[model samples]
Target chain A: MVAFIGQLGRNVIHAIAKLGDASIFAVSTLRLLFATPWQGKHFVMQLYAVGVGSLIIIIITGAFTGMVLALQGYHMLVKVGTEALLGSAVALSLIRELGPVLAALMFVGRAGSSITAEIGIMRVTEQMDALEMMAVNPQARVMLTRIVACAIALPLLVGIFDVVGLAAGYLVGVEMLGVNSGVYIGETIDKIALTDVYAGLTKSMYFGLLVGIICTYMGQRATPTTEGVAKATTQAVMICSVMVLVLDYIITSFYL
Target chain B: MIKTKGLTKTYGNVAALNDINLHIKGGEVTVILGGSGSGKTTLLRLLAGLESPTSGSIMFSGEDLAKISRKRLYELRLRVGMLFQYSALLNSLTVYENVAFPLREHTDLDKEVIHTMVTMKLEQVGLRGFEEMMPSQLSGGMAKRVAFARALAMDPQVVFFDEPTSGLDPISAGVISSLIHETTVKTRMTSVVVTHDVQAGLDIADHVILLWQGEIIAEGKSNTIKNSDDPRVQQFIEGRPNGPIPFSRSQTAYVDDLTHKPGCVRLE
Candidate 1:
């Protein structure tokens, strides 16, 4: 029991120290982010990387998610003789929660992991040191571009996921299932308020910031070794995914 | 161009460099000679201000690197360049983009001027037409040459190289060494080279400093180093397997490890 407590204490201290380090890194990124000479070309390239690279995965996942939700909602509602409510249930679930959360998770897996690995490899290969030697700040050049591009890209991607999901729900509910087309379309439109969409988008933007910070932070500080880069990439994805969900709950509670 | 007073660097419990004092004249090629773990790279990094010394000062370009503000240090770094061991070209960028990186970031020169400058640097390294190719497409020697071009793109007053001829075929090594020689002669920029290759070091270096373990074992001109009678220097330059520098027997008994003794089974 004593050894276990000692181990637990050590882990807690390590976690706190890492948290402190990340906080400082985030502050430095923000400080450089608002300064002059906004790396316009690099930002566009990163936008392409984070936005376009993850497009297909987001679309496929969004479509299947809506289908699954519609099918599940149909069965449960039909048992209660409220089958017409299927459109409302599917739209509300996706617009309020699944769209942003799933899209952020997918971004973590697809683009965010690669971004972390790239910067981590830069650290290992002495590229960061080279940048410093060249009188270029790595935080401003490498980290800021990816972080800001990620913050902007996630909302746009999440928006696309929401629209595709609504359309896919329409396909499953009206075309494949026996629901009335007009009613399904009508309910999806009427059930979702402007505030609901706003909340989801706000969550996505926050998730973008969270994932961006975690990835760049983990990557920029990766131990200078191959095993270190691999570990950092994995940890960036895992931490970003978990943080997004935790943040989703906290933000949802505000609306409630 | 560079001077160190009692310079030492230690990582945790291991001293990578210790108690080193040296002066490198401007516009001269100074080669730091050492074996794999002799802390030569550590000395070069200290000179470049990439890492701070634990106990002493590194006077780079007349200012103490460890005592300067980060802003001041960055400003001072503008006049310096370094070629890393692995080239360190951005994998995602093309060769042209890599060479032009420092110029584009630091100077607001006209695009046409930057273009001409990058072309000239590439031509100097004999990679003139390979601009659009990525670093991954280049051979090891070609990559090193491109990296050398990138390092010289800024026309730095002081340049450092970390193991320039390491991990290359003899022909490639000869090409790079000659390029270093020609560039130094033409530009008259200060050059510091860290390498384990004795022939390459002696061939290009006007002065030589032999580092062993974490300290300076010998210091003199290239001829003095070639003719030095110090056993450590002799062992290093002669490429002997045993002497003051044993393979694994100094730290752990190799025979005991072969015999699987419980206390002496480990190797460093």
Candidate 2:
């Protein structure tokens, strides 16, 4: 027990040191990012990848989620004949909880994995060192662009997901469950406050920043081996997902 | 011009480098020859200001390297090109992009000017037509050539090679050595190469420093190292195992003699 406690304490210290290192790296990178000139083509390419390329997955996930929630809510609320509340409940849940969180989580799997693997491979090949030698800051040219792109795109993507998800729920509530279209839409619009939308968008922004930093951090810090890249990719996805969930809770609590 | 004063690096109980001092003068090829783990790379990293030295000062052109801010160091680094052991080409970029990367980053040259500059650099390294090729598509020698092209893009005052001839065929090694000599002379760039290939080093280095056990065992002209009376120097130059360097058996035999046991059984 004593040995275990000692090890735990050491680990905590190490984790704090690592966090400090990451913050320094992030701040230095941000400084360079703001100083560099923005290239339109590169920014557009990254934005398209982060935004448009993610559309199909977000829509599919959001639509299915809405349909399933309506099916389940019908059974639960029918006991009190308050089935009409299903649209408002689904809209509130999607906008305030599911839309941003789910989209961010999905992005962590796709884009976050890409960032980690790309950076890890660059480290293994000494390409990042090469960039440094060339006076081309990799953090600014590569990582910062990805971060900014994600930050701008995640909110847009989440907004789209929320709209689609609510619409799907509306269709299920009215056409499938025989709930009144006017009543469902009216309740959804009235009950779901504008603050909820703002909170969701804010959460997406934070999630985007977290994903960008964590992915780049793990990738750049990867060891000089093949197995190290795989480990970094896995760790990046896992950590980003957990962070998204945790941030979601905090944001939810703030709004509530 | 680069100089180091009393540089030392210790890892726990092991001293990787011990209070060593050296000077690399202008417009000459200086080769540091050492076996693996002999602090050759540690010395290079210190000179490059990549890692902070434990207790020494590195002076580059009379400016203390340790005191140089990261921004100034970056400018200094731009003046120095280093060919990494692994070539270190960006994998996603084509040969042209990799070579043009430095020019693109530091200068506001138009695309046409960048193109011309990249072409000139590639031609200098004999990689002109290979601009379209990806790093993965190139062989070891070709990859090194592309890396050289990239390094030359900034027209640096000095170039460092980390084991340039390592892991190459004899012909490829010879070609690389010639290229190093030609490029340094053509560009008027000071070259510092770290190599275990004694013959290759002798062929290119105007001056040579033979490092052994984290110290400069020998330092002189190439011809002087070949004729040095030092037995360790003799062994290293000739690639012989039986000189001042004792093999693994010698230590074990001395220990056994102290214990009065020729061949002891296993403790278990």
Best-fitting candidate, measured by DockQ?
1
lDDT of candidate 2 over B1-268, digit per residue (tens):
9999998877777888888899998888999998887889877777777677888888999989888787788888889898888899888789999998888778899999999999988887778888888899999988988888887788889888889989888887887899889888887889999999999999899999888878889998999999999999998888887878654445456645666666665343
**DockQ of model 1, rounded to 2 decimals:** 0.81
Candidate 1 lDDT, B1-268, residue by residue in tens: 8889999899999999989999999998999999888999989988998888998988887899999988898888778889999988888889999999999888999999999999999999999999999998999899999999999999988889999999899998999999888899899999999999999999999889999998999998988988988988899999999888876646776576576776554554
lDDT of 1 by residue, A1-256 (tens): 9999999999999999999999999988889867647789989999999999999999999999999999989889989988788889998999899999999999999989999999999988888888888888888989999999899999999999998998898889888888998888788788989999998998899999899999999998888799999999999999999999999999999988
TM per prediction: 0.95, 0.90
Docking quality level of the chain pair in candidate 1: high
Worst 10 residues of 2 chain A by lDDT: A32-41
Give the clashing pairs for model 2. Answer: none
Q: State the weakest 10-residue window (summed lDDT) of model 1 chain B.
A: B259-268
Candidate 1 Cα misplacement greater than 4 A, ranges: B249-268
True contacts kept of 1: 0.82
A97 in model 2: Cα distance from truth in Å? 0.2
